[model samples]
Target: MRTAYRVETVRAAEAALMARLPDGALMQRAAAGLAGACATILGRVYGARVVVLAGSGDNGGDALYAGARLARRGAGVSAVLLGARAHEGGLAALTRAGGRVADDPFAVLARADLVLDGITGIGGRGGLRPDAVPVVRAARGSDAVVVAVDLPSGVAADTGAVDGEAVRADATVTFGAYKPGLLVDPAREYAGAVRLVDIGLGPHLPSVPELEALQHADVARLLPVPRVESDKYRRGVVGVVAGSARYPGAAVLAVAGALRGGAGAVRYVGPAGQAVLARYPETLVHAGPPGRAGRVQAWAIGPGLGDTPGVDEVLESDVPVLVDADGLRLLDPAAVRARTAPTLLTPHAGEAAALLGVARDDVEARRLDAVRELAARYGATVLLKGSTTLVADPRGDLPVRVNPTGTGWLATAGSGDVLSGLAGSLLAAGLAARDAASAAAYLHGLAARRAARGAPVAAHDVADALPGAWRDVIG
Candidate 1:
């Protein structure tokens, strides 16, 4: 699994490491790594034009030192000091290595091959200072590949919030460990690609991370595999209560995803039974509420369920339940909190906004906070669906799972319904709520990528591609 630490945790680790190391050894190690990354991006450093945007902290020192290294290698390096006071030692070193402070920052930025953004460090918040905005903008407009130091300046390292003007880098070279901002959006959107430079902070860091993203191997380990003695009942049945007369396709798509989600059988209860049977004849169909249906290990309700009456029935069941789409609307926090069984709620930004009584933009901007609050309020696991899907547990203590495998193409209609069914199937297969949600998201995204392959894909296309995605994970 890939992990990220909060800024405070990272700072503690850095301080611990610095105390044990020589006076300037830690900074030197960071500068060396930064220079190496810049050189690789430039390909041949000899004739490259490098511009270093230096601010008033250790962040500026790292950039200045890196500029010095590039200058010594025959590159023309210029430093644009944005703060009142730059790192004194780093400035002296750069000057000694044939690097000069720029007379006009814009003049050099226009001809730069690469711009090293060291304006604000991870600790700096509320975006860029007023004085540095235009210079940063000029660097961005230039042909140079903007590589942010540690983080893209202005974004909150812990929350992933880009409140104001922030550096939009072509790539970000982060030090020590991954910050939550680098992995989550809208800050993630600003950080195009991320490269981590190890400064040996791992030994000093805590065991549990602030955030975690599952990899292919991790997903493979969590996926359900039937044993030789396993039967349809033993593998587990997933009850799906979805689709109304207006949206029968939601039922079909949900069932499609459930069947491919390693579930033994799918018992569907809704008005769309005929439509579901037309597409998937093997599904055991029922005409009434989910409680009246035969035994199921888990229940998934609310996809395209316009005016559906079974939400309360599903919640009252002893088995685990997943609430999504229309089911999320008019949801009672008291009922969810009262449930003895595990409850998973899947909501997009808009749905999540409604649940929290906030603007959709707020939910999208501060996704991590929104997901956590929703999870805590409902006392259930929440899988906030978006470009970066986040799975937060009810207690709010465990690390939120950030799904890394997804394309923009996965935003099509009914895609979320497919995801809800897949996650519910995993829940029925005996996985914990957090594990089920994370694993399902990983597979769902991988399937979408496989189906789309750069073309437009329907919700059913993603469902059809699940088997291939599963094979790819296990293989």
Candidate 2:
């Protein structure tokens, strides 16, 4: 799992390290990595023009020392101080290395090829102060490639919350571990592309990372596969309780995802019963309710059972139940707790807000917190869907799994239905609730990327491409 840490904790750790080392060793190390990234962007270290937006804290010290390195290489490096008093040691290092200091920020900024935004780091409290606002705004409006030190200034480091204005960088080069804001949204959108630089602070970090993201290899290892002797039932069976005469397409899309999923058989129960057969003839459709849907390994409820009633019976099924979309609207917290089988709740921002009784913005701003809160409250694996889809199970000590293979194209309607079906199928296949959800989200996102191909696609296109995605992962 890839992680990001908070700035205050990082500062405290740096102080501890400094106590054991030479006076300026840690800052020099941070400066070395920062300079290397600058060199990479500049291509030719000696002739490139670099502008450093220096602030009052150690963040400025990092940029200043890096500027000194570039100046020695013959690059015309200039420093613009946003604060009244810049780091004294860093300022001297820049002067000694022949770097120029510009009193007029506008004149230097207009000609730069690259901008290093060190105006604020983890320690920065508010948005760019009134005076520094134009400096950052001008750079963002310009064409220069911006590289932020540690984290983009003005963005909260702990919660990924940006209450005020923040810098939007072309790339963010962070030291030690990553900060949660870089991985979560709102702030995540500002961080165009993220790169982590190790400053040897990995040993002292906590076992339960505040946030975690899965890479391709990690997903490849966790994905389940079939053995030669495995039978159809041995693989898994997912029972689907969805659809009403009012919305038959929901059942079709849900079955589309489940049938193609690794599940051995898909049993459907609901009002739009026959419509599920018309679209997915393979589905074992039944009249009445999900209680009479016979035997199955897992159950996925609430894709489109709106106001038709009798959904309570389906929700009580003691199997690996996945509650989603329409089901989320009428769900009772007490009924959810009565199930003995592992349960997974897949909610987008609005649904999560309804489940937790908070505003949508609250769920979006603190997504990591919202997801954990839902897991503890519902006592089920909660999969919060958005830019970084998170899967957390309440029964285990597992950290939430953030899906890294997602694109904005996934915002299409009915995409959530496909996800619930796929994940529910995996649950019946005997994987842990977290594993089922993380695996399904990865494949669903990958399928969306492949199906869209830079264009818009319908929900069925996503399900149609699942086999290709599964093959790409397993083969």
> 324-362 in candidate 2: lDDT tens per residue?
988889888777777787888999999999999999999
Best model number under lDDT:
1
Residue pairs with colliding backbones in model 2 are 4-178, 5-178
- Please, what are the lDDT tens digits per residue for candidate 1 over residues 1-475? 8899999999999999999999988888889999999999999999999999999899999999999999999999999999889999889999999999999999999999999999887988898999999999999999999999999999999999999999999999999999999999999999888999999999999999999999999999999999999999999999999999999999999999899888899999999999999999999999987778899999999999999799998999999999999999979999999999999999999999999999999999999999999999999999999988999999766999999998999989999989989999999998989999999999999999999999999999999999999999999
Off by over 4 Å in 2: 12-16, 395-397
Report lDDT (Cα) of residue 7, candidate 2. 68
lDDT (Cα) of model 1: 0.94
Q: Evaluated with TM-score, which candidate comes out highest?
A: 1
Taking all chains together, the TM-score of candidate 1 against the true structure is 0.99
lDDT of each: 0.94, 0.84
